[model samples]
Target: MKNKTLLTVLSIIGMGLLLGWFILQMKPPHVNEKSTPSANQQAQTKTNSPEEKYIALTPEAQQKAGIRVKVAGPVQIKTVLELPGEIQFNENRVAHVVPRVEGVITAAYKHLGAPVEKGELIAVLESRELADLKSQYYTAIKRRELAQITFDREARLWREKVSAEQDYLAAKTALAEANIVVTAAAQRLLALGLTQDALDTIPQESQSKLSRYPIRAPFDGRVVRKHVVRGEAVKADAELFMIADLSTVWGTITVYTEDLNQVHLGQKVTVRSEELGLEATGTISYLGYLIDAQTRSTQAHVDIPNPEERWRPGLFVTVEVAEKKIPVPVAVAAEAIQTYRNQPVVFVQHGNGFEVRPITLGRRSGNGQWIEMVNGLSAGERYAADNSFVLKSELGEAMAPQ
Candidate 1:
């Protein structure tokens, strides 16, 4: 009986120890079903928030994205409103030549575009009328001399009481009439556009001198066009050589009527010519008060000196009339302005990736280094300013499917 009780007690202790271990394991709580999500849900999430859409770039990709080519475009360090215009001749330096006499063509000295001095003759007309004038002058002189002789004889007779008062009076009247006739003849010759030399050298049939008319240049200029040829009969006040002096040329530019205030008298200007090369200059000389009612443009004139006569008239030129320097925003090269579905866009850097934003642009620099941003941009935004084009392409492709 004693051996049986010992075996029973040992068995009870083993069962108690097994029960305690089983309670401890149950308290620690081993779950039979899965309480955590699988790996797939962690790897791929579906959400519409920007936070979800943004994917952090790898180290290699971030470095590559930062490495961008430097490109330059117009920047509004100072905003300028450039007005356009063309070249014109100074109005003060233009002149025209015309004939003043009504006669038949005797001879012409200068050709259609020949140069001449101020007192030079243009065309000569042989007037049967002019020859008659000279004859009248000589006849009048002879008559005056005879009249004076008669008056002297009559006066002597009157003093001696041998002549009537009417005879002496008639002799004096004749002398006065002859003097008036001679004066009228000289004025007639002078009206024929001739100098004293020309009048004295007038070709006479008796003298056998050929008739000639010399035309002179009114102002120094190239013959733009001619209207008449030699021996062609032209009427009085006929249009002749159209001459202009080109020492100082006019830059005729058109601007909006509203922009008149931006320009001022004698403002300094920089002139440029593709054909003539660079760094030329001029100044604003005149501004037209009247706006072109039809075109809504005001005409402004700039005078550029043509010392070597290089600036030719009618050459189409581009002008830039600069206004006051005002501060404004501008950005990257032209290439950076990419078109997404016909919308103007630029790539803006955000975190590790980039996003597309629309921008409004203004005038480009002459060298195309910068462009003005009229709108669609704010200050203090870091853009992919230089090589934004490459990323613009990437963003466009990335969003196309979405």
Candidate 2:
């Protein structure tokens, strides 16, 4: 009985030991609680140990790469009011040439876009009206000559008492009437576009040339429009040609109701055309008092010097009017800012190299040359100003697959 009891006890102990061994085999391998981290702890560690990006460029390399550096500090940020505009001819310098008398265009000396000097002949007209006026003037001159001879004879007779006094008085009256007629005719020709010198030559000119009327340019300019052709008849007050002096141009800007208060005469303006890659500085020359009812906008003009004639009329441009200037604590060149990982970053001068720092941008200058920094930058920080893209390119290559 005792042997059976001991065997039972040993079998019970063996079963207990086998159950414990199976549980141990099913459980995972031993791991130290102190050494292993939880999910939150792992995430925290990863958040703390962020990969830093930098560009390793020497001063010599930077110079060779055309990378310029500048120190950040307080800068004046211009608040600009940008408006769309169009180039136009300066109205004060433009002219519409017209023929003062009705006539046929016998000759057209200038074509469209032809340059003309002041008093240069542009066309000639043959008009019967002009011939009639000349005829009247010459007829009066002949009568005056006859009257003068008669008056001289009458005066001598009156002094010698060889002629009756009544006869002498009648001859003198005829001479005075002739002189008045001649003076009146000359004044009429002067009013008909004839210079005093031209009138003097009328007596020497042939009858065939009496009807010839020359049209002259009033000022130095280019012919922008021509309405009459050779052999074409034109009327008085007809627009013969349009001339414009293109040395200066007008940049006409539309100032909305909201912007009218900000724009004023004598304000400095910058005109830019992206399509032509042209830029010019000017001042507001005119501001309209009336607002257009349809567009709800007022017109303003900037007089831009266009000596090269590059700023042609009808070109669309941007007019930037400087408003108030605000001083910002930090600012950098617009070229210094770049995009990295979908964030705005600037390459700051770090120890022996440049470090990519994210930034919060604020306002930008009216000229787009500088930008204000709201965060991630401070005064006195050295940064890449011009050609900062070189550093960005270098950073990209370094981060690329090796």
Candidate 3:
């Protein structure tokens, strides 16, 4: 029985040894420690690497993208007030010509778009009423001449005792009445815009010039509108022409309620027209006291000297008023600012890479073409002046899913 037990125990030991060998064979294969990295080493590699916010571009790519870089620096920041306006006729230089008497138009020497000088004849009128006045003037002159001769003769006769005193006195009285009549007729012609020279030059019994009345220009200007034609009858209150001197024009700016306080007389204003490629400088001449109820704006006038008359009435234009001048430590082109991660960022240049720099912005200039950098930027740092969006786009691509 002792020998059987010993054989059984030896069998058990053999089975245990075989099981141990199988377990050893089933274990994972060995690997080189130097070839594979630890978790801490992988994390250190990630921490040492540069962030994805930067984008590198070749010199050729930058040139092709039209990215212009400029150094941030101090600049003069002007607070300008820009407003929409229109070119208009200067009211002070505009005239509405009118005739003073009812007459038939005999001649028209001026037409629309005609340039005229002061006192230049614009038209001629013929009137029977003028003719009657001239005839009366002539009769008064003749009567006065006859009365003077009679008075002279009667006075001589009375002094020589050849005629009675009563006859001489009566002749003197008739002369006085005749003189009064002549004076009355001369005053009447003067009231009709006829000069003293014209009255004194009237010919005796002149039928040819009696009914002629000339309408002349009041100032040197261009005839913009004409309402009279030859042979057409015009009344005393008729507006015959509209003449305007284009040497100076008005730039009418519509000032909103918010801008009303900023505008004032004597402020320098610049007027520009994109369509005509014209620019002019002038001073604010007027400001309306009342605001328009519908537009909630007021009218401001700038007297622009249009010596060439390039600014025509009704032409739309933009007006820039110089409000105040400000000094800024750091200024940049407005286009340099871009949005990244929902914040304003400007691309700053490194060696061959551009870094996305977040910035705090101050008030933009009234022109909106320049901006002030309050923080996150230093003077002398090279930054993208224009076309920075290309860099921003490249950065987005770099951060995208790989």
The 0-to-1 C-alpha lDDT of every candidate, in the order given, reads 0.63, 0.90, 0.89
Q: What ordering of candidates by lDDT runs from best to worst?
A: 2, 3, 1
Best candidate per lDDT, number? 2
Per-residue lDDT for 76-174 in model 1, tens only?
543344666566777888776665544456555566545545555555555455556656655666777888899899989988999999998998888
Residue-level lDDT of model 2, residues 339-379, one tens digit each, is 98888999899866888888999999987888999999999
TM-score of each candidate structure, all chains considered together: 0.53, 0.84, 0.73
- A best-first ranking of the candidates according to their TM-score comes to 2, 3, 1
lDDT of 3 at 335: 95
Name the lDDT value of residue 53 in candidate 1: 34
**What overall lDDT, based on C-alpha atoms, would model 2 receive against the true structure?**
0.90
Off by over 4 Å in 3: 1-69, 147-184, 291-297, 334-347, 352-362, 366-369, 374-376, 384-402
Error of 2 at 267 (Å): 3.3
Candidate 3, residue 282: how far the Cα is off, in Å: 1.4
Q: What's the residue-level lDDT of 25 in candidate 3?
A: 84
Top-TM-score candidate index: 2
**How do the residues 1-402 of candidate 3 rate in per-residue lDDT, one tens digit apiece?**
999999999999999999999998896878988688899988877644433266777778889999999999887788888899999999999999887788999999998999999999999999888888877887898899999999999999999999999999999999999999989998888777777778776764368889998888989999999998999999988999999999999999999999987888998888999999999899999999998899999999999998888999999999998778798999889999998888898988989878888899986786677899999899999998779989888877776788
Least well predicted 10-residue stretch by lDDT in candidate 3? 45-54
The candidate 2 region of ten consecutive residues with least summed lDDT is 45-54
Better by lDDT, candidate 3 or 2:
2
- Residue 266 deviation, candidate 2, in Å? 3.1
Clashes of 2: 0
- Candidate 1 whole-model C-alpha lDDT, 0 to 1: 0.63
